[model samples]
Target chain A: MSTRGQLLLLWTTPVAGVLFLAAYLMFPGFSPPMSPTMTPEEVAAFLQANLTATRGVVIFVNLIGASLVPFFACIAVQMLRVGNSSPVFAYSYIICVGIGLTAFILADYCWGVAAYRPDRDPQLVSLLNDMAWFFFIAPAGLVVVQNLCLAGSIYLDARPKPVFPRWVAHFNVATAVLMIPGAFAILHKAGPLAWDGSLSFSLRLATFAVYVAVMFFVLLRVVQQPVESEGVLL
Target chain B: MAITTADAEPLPDTNGNTTAPGLVPGEASMWFFILGDLLIFGVYFVCYMVYRGEHAGLFLQSQRHLDQGIGMSNTVVLLTSSLFVALGTEAARAGKAARATRLVGIAFACGAVFPILKLVEWLPKLGAGITPGENLFFMFYYLMTGLHLVHVLLGLVILGFVLRSLRSASTPNMKFIETGGIYWHMVDLLWLLLFALFYLIR
Candidate 1:
């Protein structure tokens, strides 16, 4: 297998395995946040009221997740580089990914997951918690693994023997770095848009503004075919 | 010598010449592409599970409202249709164009039955005003199954075109056959996932 084939296989295999045994694995570290029910105005009022170390950490971790998307975007070309898919397949690939793109554009994970209240109906909350657990097993796992694999694949491909072009490697590196801020943003949300404390409103908007800007650049790149060498697609 | 082509295979437009080392095409990455799609939808699937687990009661409540038989029937329809496409691929590869075309026609008909069945399944939900983004159940139902349905429709369209092409074209290339087969398999694969995720989520 080519390096990427191996990388993708490795990248994808764990996700598949985990989803298969999803019910078995215990999701560690990333606990669900409180489920608050504050209104938008209340959320704005709360953001103005607090700044602390723990709050910063939450924002930072969430930032890491939300910002990780560009790396996924970087993979778009590299994955395509690995082979010539049928036009329909290619079209579907992009469309399916386009759906995934909603996460970044909406930034709901940080805004909703992190900022919500913990004290809702015990029954309903427990149900939401279980559902969240299910999510961590597959979609969340794949997102992390896929991003890491794309980064690794790009790096490995950058090595002289790799089939992908050098630019993809550089793109991967840049993408990994670029993804951090948005990830932090995603990690900072609440079930209630009103209550969770993460970043200043200005920073949130600025973070999202930067995210949207970067996302546009990445989206443009994903749509354009990368320039390739004799045996490599950049 | 004037290249009066009684033997030159028509460029996939019509079938005339048959004296050949079969104008076969190369391998396709359709499987790879489908795997890629699986990965993409795989995320959504996980998301559904996560959310479902968190809100199991709601989802189960919503699921209870669905007709399991309808979902199961659609699954059977797609699987059998997929088999027909495979048969078509085999016959086409063997240079039995007529048999391949017939199989493709059957496959197309099978593929056609799906959205019809889905339409029937969806009517009750539509009447109930259930839709994606409304709640966890509708969200996964429409997002996952709706997206799958779109792919099915697209597959049927492709299958129809290929069937038509098969009937009209005299000479067929194995490459086209292979690629078309790959496309059909993707359609089939998506349905399998839909069946697993949409119907069996409970």
Candidate 2:
């Protein structure tokens, strides 16, 4: 194998394993602790009452997640490569993901613990909450990160030798701009900008949906012939 | 087969910043795509994190149920696969075509094993009657790690391609290996996280 190939493999292998392990180990009921409001006895009763279908959606999600991760990742890797701005954006994307992953996982375990042990220290509980707040739940910083990547992709594609199309560029910009409110909407609370982040979460997400649909359409259009190798798409 | 865009003459020295000039256009574009993907993953992650925040005890209480041994074994599988990928790249660069082919084959094999082992690990659990929405923690667990599994399958497919290319005397290109390797590294990194998330926390 070439050194470049070696380097690529080094980065990807662990991620692949994690993907696999995550699928299996992080199953439904692996981290059970749902009824924060009810006492343990009451919680058991509640679970007994609503036993059949409660975790069904989550299992459905697992089936879906098991499928989507690889497919999306491939597209993502290829899309970034469709043009040539790897050096500028690679580390940022990975690091940000690294941060997000850490946050997600930490919050995951902490949530499990807190759920199981209701009598745990309030401070510890709060600290865990804070961790999730900073790391997992809020979509604010990440929304920008996505846009930045999209913008970078467009900016690169907008190059003289354009590997992608001009419409794709326009589409990326529109998506980036439209996604701004989503970050705040994710929290469903008064963020720094206030005002309920402009109403419903669905609306915020809907704006992004437009971006996703358009971007995918544009990507399909651009991929028909990605011939220009010499220049950045931007 | 015939002269394509690559056969086009190298442009005159224009940009002076060709430091690691080996980085190909294909490689660079992949990075861009990966970065974008990260954002999507980040959003999902953010969702997981936010919910986790409100219910820390609920989350960790269940985290202790994890089986650390299997998690660690998967990590080993990933790390070993990475090493094989690296060695495979080296073999190709050295022009030892057969060596390169074998190493890539091993890497691919390693990749395959991880997912299979994953299945082996999960089968019993599904049978055990545990489920997501069993609690708040389970929800995120299924969401985060489930996403990761999909990536693993994809990696396995890609690795299979790399190995096939090797047999054809196409001898995996340095750029392909590097790109794939970097991606492999990302998979490995995610596992360390799983360990921390599921096992370490408890």
List all candidate RMSDs to the true structure.
17.8, 20.1
Query: lDDT tens digits, residues A1-234, model 2?
Result: 112322343344345445534543443322332312334455444434443433443343334333323323323443444455444454455555555455545544554444444345555554543443333344435545755765576567634666456566566566556556544533444533322234223344456445544544454444444343423221
Error at A9, model 2, angstroms: 54
Query: Which lDDT tens digits does candidate 2 get at residues B1-202?
Result: 1213342478896434333656552267677667776777668667766766778788777776666777778878888888887887778778777887788778777777887777766677666765675777776676667777888888877777676666774544656656776677677677667657656765
Worst 10 residues of 2 chain A by lDDT: A1-10
lDDT of 1 by residue, A172-231 (tens): 445444333333423434432211223322233334345334544544444343332223
**What DockQ do the predictions score, one after another?**
0.02, 0.02
Report the number of the highest-TM-score candidate: 1
**Clashes (candidate 1):** 51
Off by over 4 Å in 2: A1-234, B1-20, B24-26, B43-50, B170-172
Q: What's the lDDT for residue B98 in model 2?
A: 88
